[model samples]
Target: ARDGILVVRPDSGELPKIVLDVLESLAGKFGTSNTPTGHKLLPPKIRVIQGDGIDINSLEMILKTMTAAGWAADNLAFGSGGALLQKLHRDTQKCAFKCSYAVVNGEGVDVVKDPITDPGKKSKKGRLSLEKNADGTWSTITEGKGDPAKDQLVRIFLNGDLTVDEKFQTIRDRSNVGL
Candidate 1:
């Protein structure tokens, strides 16, 4: 007969005021709805997962303190372990791939590293060019002095070849276009 909705995770405390005191003690013991954007929502059998200290700034401060106390971000349901994948690495977001332009004997070289004890690990020298401005914003253009007909960069490897394969939903619909 197990119907459904009985979530209630909670895993430890202080998570944005204990997830609004466990969603106001589960909406005062099972009961609540009012949402045409007014918020509140908590009773369809009972929910509220939260999974302890989740990240992204404590899940946007617990959905902005549960929508400023009125509630309903669909009444809670978030879970993250090791802050969504064990504290990541590669400088945890400063990421790195370096190698800005190189050719060697045929001469093209611009490559840079710039380290005197980390100038924010500076590295960017030539051949980069991204460009998509005119207010829409997106400028890279380092050394190789940009503008290869307003390059939007699309080569996807060449020598060992795989020159553009794409199709992971066409690179997630080109990374969700303007979203």
Candidate 2:
């Protein structure tokens, strides 16, 4: 009846139903109360974390279900298992890798389109490079100006030939990104 902490993790089953079921189970065991905002609050000593079958929609649905049932949002946590990003297609973010700028007929040209139907579909123009701002955040700039030697972007290939290829693991390690 005495301990440091207790965290119940449920990683299997359909998310929307399972999450609510777990919340009800916890309430039945550890009990719950109404918050000042009139939402059900779980006992602070215990909490639940769900880690599977979660996407943006599912996450939103879970939270909505919890709130509808009077459960506080703090009663549970979610782990996406990288699905949040991995499951996304380029179109989900409105990303199109078309050549926004290119050299044509020995002349520099800025190419872009601002569709009247969807203004958000407008793309950038001219050559682009990421530059570090004075506040340490990155901003995309057209027509590169920073010193080529110091900037972080590296050239790996040119002219349809692999110039600086590395193993997949090496690339992941070098970029410090995990998937």
Candidate 3:
């Protein structure tokens, strides 16, 4: 790093221990300095990227441990894989689908799941559409409300047939990170 080459990776073992050991070792060898906020920072060319066995809690714990060890948060970078795939924000929220609205005997019924004891079970009523507002932020417009023409929801399947298809690269390019 002193010569401006950065190539460090930590893939196995206990994440926090490995990260702490590597950082301390680097600091001892190349030295460190305190940032304006008093966080210890290592030389710019040398750093560690923890890639394996990384979960949300482990990531937070690693950062906290780094902070407690007087190391700056920027000294480490993270790669996402099984940890991200297995533990996602959607899983934490316990997301589920319920019939929030239905047409019974030609009568529109606003159905909602609300338990008297658990407010967390409460859900929106009517239909939903993901649309982008004029301000350029995407939002879930409920109650069968939204400009049908500009709706972001794509009709990928219809009547037991897949209507929309694209190459893997095309799909990947359409992700949020792509734009």
Evaluate all candidate structures by whole-model CA lDDT and list the values in order: 0.78, 0.74, 0.77
Off by over 4 Å in 1: 1-33, 36-53, 56-64, 75-82, 89-93, 96-154, 157-179
Return the top candidate by TM-score.
2
TM per model? 0.27, 0.46, 0.45
- TM-score-sorted candidate list, best first: 2, 3, 1
Clashing pairs in 2: 40-70
Task: Estimate, for each residue in 31-87, the C-alpha lDDT of model 2 and write its tens digit.
Answer: 888889998778888888886657888889999988887889998888765567787
Q: What is the overall TM-score of model 2 with all chains considered together?
A: 0.46
Q: Which pairs clash inside model 3?
A: none
Candidate 1: the clashing residue pairs are none
Better of 2 and 3 by lDDT: 3
**Each prediction's number of clashing residue pairs:** 0, 1, 0
Put down candidate 1 lDDT per residue, 1-179, tens digits, no spaces.
47887888763556687778878887888779898877889877788888655778889888988888788888778877665678664555766788888788888888888754457768778888888998778888873576789888887986678987877998899888988
